[model samples]
Target: MTTSSDQQHREAALTDTVLRSFESCTDPRLKLVLQSLVQHLHDFIRDVRLTEDEWRTAIDFLTEAGHITDDKRQEFILLSDVLGASMQTIAVNNEAFKDATESTVWGPFFVDGSPEIPLGGDMTLGAAGEPCWVEGSITDTDGNPVPDALVEVWEADENGRYDVQYRDGRTAARAHLRTGDDGGYRFWAVTPTPYPIPHDGPVGALLAAVGRSPMRAAHLHFLVRAAGYRELVTHIFVEGDELLADDAVFGVKASLVKQFERARGATPDGRELDGRSWSRVRFDIVLAPHGS
Candidate 1:
C-alpha cells in the first residue's frame, strides 16, 4: 500500500519533472510562467485528490464553452467572469494610483468600430429603453482636462438585452464619441437596467449548480482612451441597484456608483422629450499617467 507520504512524494516528483521539461523554453517569462503554472496546478490536483470523473467533467465543460464561442459570443470570457478570474486579473494589473478611476471586467459583448456620435447626440439609435443623458469630463490625475479623448460606451436595454443578443444584427445602445476641447462629453443613451449575463450555456450551468445568480447590477459601460494615459475600462453602477453587492462578475466598486436623477419635459441640450420621463447622470473620469 502506498502511504500518504509516498503519494505526496510521487506527486512532487511528477511536478518537478514537468517543471524541468520547460527548462529549454527560450523566453525567460514563458519559462517562469510555465514552471509556476505546473507547480500550482499540481498542488491543486493533489489537494483535491481530483477524481478521474471530475477531471473528465471539467474537460467536457471547457469543450462545450469553446463550441459555443464565435464572433458574436465569447463563452470563454463569460467563463472567466463567472469564476471571478476576470476581476482578479483586472485587479492585478490595475494598481492603486492617485484617484485614477477604477477598472473592471471587459464583458464579452464589446464590438469594434461602433458608430460614432457627436457630443450631445443620441446613441440609442432606436433601442427600446427610457432615454437618459450621460455627461462626464475626462481629466488627468492633476485635474487638467484631457481633450480629444475617445470614449466608447455600450449597455443593455430595458429588457436587459444587448444589440448583439438579437438575431437581426442591428446596433443600438452603444457608440463612441470624442471629448470636447474642455474634456466634456454628453450624449443621449438608454438608462441602464439590471440584467442576467447570458446564462444558457456552460457558464450558466456552472452558476446554477453552485446556486449563484448570474445577474449583474444596472450600469453603463465605458472604455476611455487618451494619449499619454492608461486606458480606463469601467462601469458606473446605478446607486441603488440591489445586485450591487453581488454582481455576477464582481465588477462593482464603491467609487463607481452614481445616482441617476429623474428628469422630465426638457433636456439640458433643449431637446423635447414630449412628456416622456428620463434620467441624467454624471461620471467624471480621472486617468493615470501611462507609467503610473
Candidate 2:
C-alpha cells in the first residue's frame, strides 16, 4: 500500500510542475498572476480534499451561470457578487486616500451611453417611484473643485426592477450629467427602495443552498470621472435601510451611507410637487489623484 506521506509529496510535486509550466509566459505580470492563482487554487483543492463529484458540480454551476448571462443580465458578475469576490477585487484596487470616496462593486446593471441630463434636471424620465432631489459636489483631496466631471447615476424603480429588466427597450432611471464650474450637480431621481437581486439564476440557487437572501440595500449608483483623478465608482445607501447590514453584494461602506430626508413643501428648483411628498439627499464626493 502507498504511504499517506508519499501521496502528499506527490500532490505537492504536481503543483510545482504546474507552476513551472508558466515559465514561458512572456508577460511578467501575467506570469506572476498565473503562478499565484495556481498556487492558491491547488492549495485549496488539497486542503479541502475536493472530490470529483464536487468538482463536477462546481463546473456545472459555472456552466449554468454562463448560459444565463446576456446583455441585460450578467449571471457571472452576480455569482461573483454573491460570493463577495467582486467586492474583494474592488477593495484591493481602490486604495484609501485622504477623505476620498470609497469605491464599491460595479453592479451588472450599468449601461453605456446613458442619456445626458442638465444640472438640476430630472433623471427619472418617467420611472415609477417617489421623487427625490439628489445634490452633490465633486472635489479633490485638497478641497479644490473638479469642474466638468462626468457623473453617471442609475437606480432601480420602486418595484426593484431596472429598465433593462423590462426587456421593452426602454431607458429610465438612468442618466449622466456634467458638473458645474463649482463642481456641483443636482438631479431629480426616485427614492431608492431595497430589492432582491436576480434570484432565479445560478447565483440565486447557490444562495438558497447556503440559506442566504439575495436582497440588496436600497441605494443609488454613481460613477464619477475627471480629467486627472482616479475614476470613482460608488453608491449611496439609505441610512435606515434594513438591508444595509446584509447587502447581497457586500458593497456598503459607512462613509457611503446618507440620510434621505423627507420633504413635503417646495421643491429645490421651485418645481411644484402639487401636494406630493418627496425626498432629498446630499452627497458631496472627494476624488483621489491618479496613482494615489
Candidate 3:
C-alpha cells in the first residue's frame, strides 16, 4: 500500500511546522535539545504507528508513577532503570576523563542529607547483619589524588528495608564522609544483600505483567563528590553475587564489581566481632578532572 502524494505532504508539513517553530529561539542549547527530542519522538510515532490505547496506557503509567513518589523514592528512576535508559544516559555523559570515576544512576532510593560519620565508621548504625567493610579512594582521571572528596553513601538495612520503609524504628543508613589526605577512605557497613524493588506500585504491576523479577542483587550505593571534579553516583557489587547480571534496576557495570574478602583479624576497634567473624572489602573510586 502506497500513500498518496497529498498524504505524504501532510505528514511532512506537520514535521516541518513543528521543527521550524523552534528555530527562532535564541538559546542554542535549548534549541538543540528541543530539535532532537522532536525528531526522535516523531520518528517513534511514525515507526510504531502507536494505537490510541497504547498512548492512553502510557499516560496512565506516568500519572501513576508521579502519584507513587515520596521523599525517599523516585518512580521515574525505577521506570528508567527497568528500561536501561538511565544507565545508558549516564554512560554516555560520563565518558572517561583522564582518571575520573564514571557516573551511574542515582537510583530512586537516595535520600539526601544523611548523617555525617567518621572514617572507618559503620553506616549501618548497629543494624543486624553480616559485617562488611567498604574502602576506596578518589583520584583524578590522571590517577592524581583528589583529597577531601566527600563520599556520601546509602543502602537498605538487614531486613531488606530502607529507613523510609520502616515506621519510626531506627535511623536510615545514610552517611557522609570525606576522603583522607591520600584520597583513600574506608567505612564499615553490613554486606549488602539482595532486595526486591517495591512490588506494590504501578511499576511493579508492569513488571509482573511482563513476567519480570523485582529483585535487585546486593550492592553498596555511593554518591562521591570532590572539589573541582564531577560528582559520581554508583554501586559496588560483591563478587559471585547471584544477581549481578540481573539487577532489577539494571544498574550494574562490569567495572564496578569488587570482591568482598573475608578478614580474620579483629575489627577496627581491636575487638572481636562478637566472636563470630568479620569480612573486609576495599572499593576505590577514580574521578574525572575538572573542565573535561
Candidate 4:
C-alpha cells in the first residue's frame, strides 16, 4: 500500500527528473532560467496542494486566453495587467529613470501607424469628448531640450472605447507628431475618461472570480523616441481621478499625475480658442540616456 512517505518520495523524484532533463541545454542562461522556473513551479504546486481538477481548470483558462488573442486584441497581456505582472516588470526594468518620466504599462490597445499630425493639430477627429489641449516638451535628464523627437499619442474616446474596439478599420483619437527645435510639441485631444479593460474574455472571468473591478483610471498614452535616448512608454493620468488610486493595472504613479485645468477664451500660447471653454494640460517629459 502506498503510504504518505511514498507519495512524498514520488513527488521529490518527479521534480528531480524534470530538472535533470535540462542538463543538456547548451546555453547557460537558458539552463539556469529553466531550472529556476521548474523549482518555483514545483514549490508553488506543493504549497497550494494543487488538485488535478484545479490544474486542468488553469490549463483551460490559459488556452482560452490564447484563443481569444488576435491582431487587435491581446488577452494574455490583459491577464498580465490584471495580475500585476506587467507593472512588476516595468518596475524592475525602469529603476534608472527616476528623474525622467516614469514608465507604465502599455495597455493592449496600442496600434501602430497613427496618422502624423502637425503641431497644434486636432487629434480628436470629432470623436465625442470634452476638448482638451496637450502641450509638452521633451528634454534630457539634465534639462536640455531633445529636438526633433517623435511623440506618438493614443487614447480612448469619451466613452472609454478605443478605435480598435469597434473593429471598423479606422483610427480615431490617435496621432503622432515631431517636437520642434525647442523640444516642444502640442496637439488637441479629448479629455480622458475612466473605462474598463476588455472584460469579455478569460481575463475578465478571472477578475470576476477574484471579486475585483477591471476599471482603469483616466489617462493618455504617450511613446516618445529620439535618436540617442531610451524610448519611453508611459501615461499622463488626470489628477483627482477617482480611480487613480485603484487602477486595475496599477500603472498610476504620483509623479505622473497632472492637473488638467479648465480654461476659457484663450489657449496657453495666446491663440484665441473658438469661444468654447476647454481643458488644458502641460506635461514636460524628460528622457534618460540610452545606456542609463
Candidate 5:
C-alpha cells in the first residue's frame, strides 16, 4: 500500500540520491558537471527503460574490449573513433587560430622517447618497399621559418603496421628530427599503405553487428612542439587513399590531404637508387604565432 505522498517523495529523492555520492566534491565546476551528467544519464535510462539484457550486452562488449588490448593495440581508442567521439574531442579543442594548421587526431600509436635522428636521414633503413622522400617546412602563418622546431613524426611500416606493434619493447622505425636552419626537415620512409584497424576487439564486434568495416587511410602522424608557437598534433593524409571517406576514426580533413606523386626515373635531387619506385611528398606546416 504505497501512498501518493510516498511516491512523490521517492521521485523527489532521485536527485538527492544521485548527488549524495558527490557531496564531498569541492570544485563547483566539477560538481556541476557531475550533477548534470547524472541527471541526463538517469533521464535517459528512464526514458528508454533499458532492459537488463541490453545492459548486460554492454558490459560484455566492454569486457571483450579490455581483453583484446595488450601492448600495442588500443581497441578502446578505435571504438571512440568509430563512434565519432574522438573527432568531437578534437573539434572542441581546436578553436585557436583560424590561420594556423588544423589539429587532427593524436591517434593511439604515439610512443614515448623516439630515438633522436639527424635531418634527411632515412627511417626505413632495413627493408625497402617504396621510395618516399618526405620534406616539410614549419613556419608561421606570415611566412617566417620556425627554426629548431621539434618535429616528431611516425607512420606505419611497409606492411601497414607500426614498429611497436611488431617490435615489442624495442624502438623500431620511429624517430624524432629537428628542423634545420632553413626551417625544413626531410626523412625517408615507406609510402604508407592503407590498413585495417584491429577488428577482433569489442569494437570490431560492435561494428560487425552493424555491418561496418574497420579501416584507416594511409597517413603520416606528426606532433610539432616549439618554444614560441602553439603545439600542433596533426596528420598528413596521402591523396587518393581509399579509406579517406570511410576512415574508422573519422580523422580526415580537407586541409591535411597532400599529394604523393611518383618520382621521375632517376633525376637530380641528391636522391639515390632503391629498387622500389619512389614517391615524393612536400608538407608545409603553418604554426600559430607565439602567444596568440
Candidate 6:
C-alpha cells in the first residue's frame, strides 16, 4: 500500500529528477532562471496542496486567454496588469531613477506611426471632449534641458474608448511631437476620463472572481526618448480622479499626479482656441542618463 511517507518520497524524487534535467542547459542565465522557476513552482504546488482538477482548470483558463489574444488586443499583457506583475517588474527595473520621472505600465492601446505635430499644435483632431492644453519640458536629472526629444502621446476620448476599440480600428486622439530647442513642448488634447479595461475575456472572468473593479484612473500616456537618455514610458494622472487610489493596474504614482485647471479664454500662448474654454496642465519630465 502507498502510504503518506511513500508519497512524499516519490514527490521529492520527481523534483530532483526534473532539476537534474536542467543541468545540461548551455546558457548560464537560462539555467539559473529555470532552476529558480522550477523550485518556486513546485513549492507553490506543495503549499497549496493543489489537486489535479485544479491544475486542469488553471490550464483551461490560460488556454482561453491565449485564444482571445490577437494583434488588436493583448490578453497576456492584460493578465500581467491585473495581477500587478507588470508594475512590480517596472518597480524592480526602475529603482535607480527615484529622482527622475516614475515609470508605469504601457497599456495595450499604443499604436505606432502616430502623426507628428508641431509645438503648440492640436492633437484633439475634433475628438469629443473638453479641450485641454498640455505643456511641458524635457530635461535631464541635473536640470539640463534635452532638446528635440521625441514625445508620443495617446489617450481615450471623453467616452473612455480608444480608437482601436472602434469596429474600423481608426486612430484618433493620438499624436507624436518633438520638444523645441528649449526643451519645451505643447499640444492640445481632450481631458482624460476614467475607463474600464476590456473586460470581455478570461482576464475579466478572473477580476470578477476576485471581486475587483476594472476601472483605470483618468490619465494621459506618454513615451519620451532622447539621445544619451533612458527611454521613459509613463503617464500624468489627473489630480483628484476618483479611481486614483484604486487603479486597476496599480500604475498611479504621487509624483505623476498633476492638477488640471479650468481656463476660459485663449491658450497659454495667446492663440485663440475658436472661443472655446479649455483645461490646462503643465507636467515637466526629467529623464535619467543611460546606465545610471
Q: What's the CA RMSD for each of the models? A: 1.3, 1.5, 2.1, 2.3, 3.5, 2.2
Best lDDT goes to which candidate? 2
Cα RMSD, model 3: 2.1
Error of 5 at 108 (Å): 1.7
Off by over 4 Å in 1: 1-3
- Candidate 4, residues 147-265, lDDT tens digits: the string is 99999999999898999888667789999999999999999998899999999999999889899899999999999999889889999999999999889999999999999998888
lDDT of 2 by residue, 176-197 (tens): 9999999999999999999999
lDDT of 3 by residue, 1-292 (tens): 4668997778778988999999999999999999989988877876777789999999999999999887767888888888888888988878787545556778777776788888887788866677777777777766777888888888887788877777675676768898889998888888788899888888899999999999888878899877787778888887899898888877877777888887776776564576766677787788765556
Residues 1-292 of candidate 5 have per-residue lDDT tens digits of: 2348776567558867987889789998999899888888776755576689988998888888888877678878888888998889888876768569888887778887887888888766453357678898988888889889998888877777777777545455567889998899888767877877767668877888998887788888889988888888898888988789988788899889999988757723577675447888999998986666
**What's model 4's overall lDDT?**
0.91
lDDT, candidates in the order shown:
0.94, 0.95, 0.81, 0.91, 0.80, 0.90
- List the candidate numbers ranked by TM-score, top first: 1, 2, 6, 4, 3, 5
- TM-score winner between 1 and 5, please give it: 1
- State every prediction's TM-score relative to the real structure: 0.98, 0.98, 0.91, 0.94, 0.88, 0.95
Predict model 6's lDDT versus the native: 0.90
What are the per-residue Cα lDDT tens digits for candidate 1 across 102-204?
9999999999999999999999999999999999899998999999999999999999999999999999999999999999999999889999999999999
The order of the candidates by lDDT, greatest first, is 2, 1, 4, 6, 3, 5
